[model samples]
Target: MELAIGIILGCCALGAGICMGIGAIGPGIGEGNAVSKACEAIGRQPESKGAVTSTMIMGCAISETTGIYSLVIAILLIFVAPNILVNVLLKAIGLM
Candidate 1:
């Protein structure tokens, strides 16, 4: 029983770490690309800097949602999944 609980908690921690690590990669790359392109656009058309900047900001915010979602899921896995999994394990072994 102790082993099982330890495994469950360990797996949850591992999963959360993996989830955040992978999830952050996309947004980091995307935001970098978006900012680069936005800078080029502003350079090409200084008069349209306001519009381009606003659009870039909006797009970056939208792109960041995926990372935020992963963060939420990671939080759930670290804080919530282990308890639920342990309860299920206990029930399966007829101990609960």
Candidate 2:
């Protein structure tokens, strides 16, 4: 039972780590692509620089929300999962 609990906790931590690690990739790529395109647009039409920048910033900020959620989940999993698991374990063992 203890071993099972430990394994569950470990899995949660590992999953959280993976989630944060892989979850960042999409936003990173998207932000990079957005900036690159925005730069190109500005280069082509310097007069539209301000508008392009503002739009790019807005788009990037929206795109970043998923990464932020993943980060929050990762943090919760890292900090909260173990405690919840421990509590469940204790309850299962009739010690809580």
Candidate 3:
């Protein structure tokens, strides 16, 4: 039972890392592309730079939000879940 718990914790940590790693990739690329396009658009149309800059900032913010969400999930999985599980296990074992 203890071995199983250890294995589960390890898997959770690994999974969380993998999830965050995968999650960061697409959003990073997308945010980069958004800024690039926004700058290009502004350069092409100086009069509309304000609108383009605002839209770019909004899009980048949204894209970054996804990465933040993933980081939250990863932290929960790696740090929070295992601690909760250990507490639950102690309670079950009548050691808490």
Q: What is the C-alpha local distance difference test score of candidate 1?
A: 0.97
The candidate scoring highest on lDDT is 1
Q: What RMSD value applies to candidate 3?
A: 2.5
lDDT of 3: 0.88
CA RMSD (A), model 1 = 1.1
TM-score of each model, paired residue for residue:
0.92, 0.87, 0.74
Worst 10 residues of 1 by lDDT: 78-87
Q: What's the CA error at residue 92 for candidate 2, in Å?
A: 0.9
Candidate with best TM-score: 1
Give the clashing residue pairs of candidate 1, or none.
Answer: none
Query: Which sequence of candidate numbers ranks them by TM-score, best first?
Result: 1, 2, 3
- Model 3 misplaced stretches (Cα beyond 4 Å): 87-96
Candidate 2 per-residue C-alpha lDDT over 1-96 given as tens digits, one digit per residue, 9 for 90 to 100: 769887988999899989999999999999999999999999999999999999999999999999999999999999988889888888888988
Positional deviation of residue 79's Cα in model 1 after best superposition, in angstroms? 1.3
Itemize residue pairs with steric clashes in candidate 2: none
- Candidate 2, residue 15: Cα displacement in angstroms equals 1.2
lDDT tens digits by residue: candidate 3, 21-74: 999998999999999998889888899988898888999998898899899999
